[model samples]
Target: MQLEPDDSQSDRPVPSLAAPEFAAGDRVRMNALGRSRHPRYGERQAVVVRKVAANGWRVLFEGRTSLLTIHRDYLEKVEPV
Candidate 1:
């Protein structure tokens, strides 16, 4: 099922026009430097399962079946550590 944008945000933000960054199975980390922490920040370290759109991506945490749709701006590629 697709998610609906929050009604509280009356001024809808424009979607990014850039190309999708991460591919399926790519690992990513949330950029929490300037942005506020997400309610599900615990899943910041996740693997990209698919691209939702040019500006959105679907990611899944290790051992979790449910995937979350996250904005591209909030995500950064994770290098092997």
Candidate 2:
């Protein structure tokens, strides 16, 4: 999904938070915090293999590759590394 800046305020750019820091080859667990029709597998744990775009991160989970291109605001840092 393309992230378009809000048109209500043309003078100001779309405010965005800093992206979370997760390197490739890092293990991560993603939780479903919102409603969507993407998949019904619930929360999942996966390994970060590569980053596709500025806001898109590709993960390898259960021998399958899934693309999670989420906004930076929705992600939270986890411990237990």
Candidate 3:
């Protein structure tokens, strides 16, 4: 499913226009500087398992077993040619 802009945001950071719509099975990469303290922060890539919200996604990071809900700001769509 695609993300719709969240007009309910109060103090939260708004989602960027550059952030692509995510779907299950799509490959994505986590920003190296995103979520510095997250356990999966070291992982460079992941698969989008679900879009949890307009700004969050459930991802399965490469080399990891557990699924992590990472914000969309930290992910970029990996369009394969």
RMSD list, candidates in order: 7.5, 7.3, 7.9
- Answer with 2 or 3, whichever has the higher TM-score: 3
- List per-prediction Cα lDDT, in the order shown: 0.72, 0.53, 0.76
Candidates arranged by TM-score, highest first:
3, 1, 2
Off by over 4 Å in 1: 1-20, 33-39
- Cand. 3 Cα-lDDT: 0.76
Top-lDDT candidate index? 3
lDDT of 1 by residue, 1-81 (tens): 999877887544334466338889899877753135565564457899988755788988667789988888777788887
- How much is the lDDT of residue 32 in candidate 1? 55
- What TM-score quantifies how close candidate 3 is to the native fold? 0.65
In TM-score terms, candidate 1 sits at 0.63
Per-residue C-alpha lDDT of model 2 across residues 1-81, encoded as one tens digit per residue: 999876878643233555466777776655443113225433555666676667656666555555655433333334665
Q: Is candidate 1 or candidate 3 better by lDDT?
A: 3
Cα displacement (Å) at residue 75, model 2: 4.9
Greater-TM-score candidate between 1 and 3: 3
